[model samples]
Target: MTYDDLLRRAAALARPGHRAILGIAGSPGAGKTTLARRLVRDLGDIAAHVPMDGFHLADAELDRLGLRDRKGAPETFDAGGYAALLRRLRDERGEVVYAPGFERVLEQPIAGAVPVPPGARLVVTEGNYLLLDTGSWVRVRGELDEVWFCAPDEEDRVRRLVARHEEFGKSHEAAVAWVLRSDQRNAELVAGTRERADLVLTAAQLPEP
Candidate 1:
């Protein structure tokens, strides 16, 4: 579908009386964040963007758990916290709600970085494990009105992932290694949950990378 098509569908979810939460799920580098931001930007004040990356555990905590090497894995995030935030966004309690945001430079989650005002009728959230049906992740799907999966070409996805790592200070060789090892594993796991999404989209339907 085109971006305009997606925008119309998102707008439809916020029909007459209720607020809605729309989720964008995909493997690493599949453009979930890009699509979520585009939806929010196109919809303007009616929507808000709340990313799941904000729930990533701090680097020091990852080090303490010996999970620093597998940073983007599902286990590395605060899944329960993410679920709670989604619940709050769904509630739309007539007050502003704060959500965390990830800082690429620091590679950490910054608290209270995103604000969802009371007037927003839609909350656009994107993440890797939104359709994952294990442990704390099971609570996620129940909180979202619908989840869209993004599936980009595998080669392009890998290239984008490697470039992102390099952009954040990793050497080219290290970036490739990480993408092939850690990121690829997570990507494969996320792919398994694709069938559960309400809709599936491709990179072509999103903004140019």
Candidate 2:
């Protein structure tokens, strides 16, 4: 399917009386965030983007836990907190719900950053572990109305991931090493959950940002 078809399907999930949450799950560099952002932008007022990256554990906390090196791993995030927020979003309690936002430059999560107004009928959330069945990640699937998985070509995904790391201040060599070591492991884990998704998307289905 084309990107337009995906948009139409996502938009159709929003009924007049019910709120829907659409989850975009993929490995690192699979373009989950890009797709979610595009969906929200195209959907406009009826949709809101609430990324799971917002639930990343603080850098200090990561150091305390000794998981700083595995920053993008599932364990590095506050999985329980993320699940709780999704529950709150699903409940639609008629209040403005505030979610954290991750700053790529600072590599920290800003608290109460993204506000989801009560009027929004569709919530688009994207992240790596959304489809994972481990621990608190299992709770995420229940809250989401539908979850779509994205799988681009492995070489392209790795290239994008390396470029992203370099753009965020890592040296080219360091970015390549990080992608091969840290991000690749996380990607493998995420890839195992592809079968659990409601739909699987490919690069052909995505549009350029």
Candidate 3:
């Protein structure tokens, strides 16, 4: 289906008195963030964007645990904290709720950077591990009303992933190496969870807002 078609379906998720959450899952550089931001923008005041990148462990924390090399892996995140935030978004409807945001250049998570107001009927969150059925990650899928997985062309995805790393401060060679060694492994894990998604989307299926 086209972006417009998905927009209509997303809009329909909001009811008179309930809040619904839509999850966008995909491998690194699959355009999950782009699609999610566009959908929330098109849906206007009814929607809010809450990206899962916000749960990334700080560099200091990663260093302490000696997991810095596995930065993008599922273990590098505060999965339980993310799950709790999702649960709060689903149940605490009376007041404004704040979710964390990540800074790409610094590669750090900023706390209380995103606000989900009471008026927001739908929350659109995107991430790589949304569909993972392991450990604390398992709690993620249960909170989302429907999860959509992005499946872009492999070559295109790799190109974008490499470019992103470079844009955020890595050298060309370093970016490519990181993409192939680290990102690729995480991508494979995320790909395995695609079948569990309610819908699968391609880059062509998503349009600019």
Top candidate, metric lDDT: 3
The 0-to-1 C-alpha lDDT of every candidate, in the order given, reads 0.92, 0.91, 0.94
Task: Summarize candidate 2's per-residue lDDT along 88-169 as a digit string, tens digits.
Answer: 8878649899999999999999999999998899999999999888899999888998999999988889999999999999
TM-score of 2: 0.97
* lDDT (Cα, 0-100) at 121 in candidate 1: 89
Task: Report the C-alpha lDDT of model 3 over 45-137, residue by residue, as the tens digit.
Answer: 999999999999999999999999999999999999999999999999989999999999889999999999999999999999999999999
In candidate 1, which residue pairs clash?
none
After superposition, the stretches of candidate 3 with alpha carbons farther than 4 Å from their true spots are none
**Candidate 1 per-residue lDDT over residues 15-60, each given as its tens digit:** 6556899999999999988888888888989899999999999999
| Candidate 2 regions with alpha-carbon error over 4 angstroms | none
Query: What is the overall TM-score of model 1 with all chains considered together?
Result: 0.97
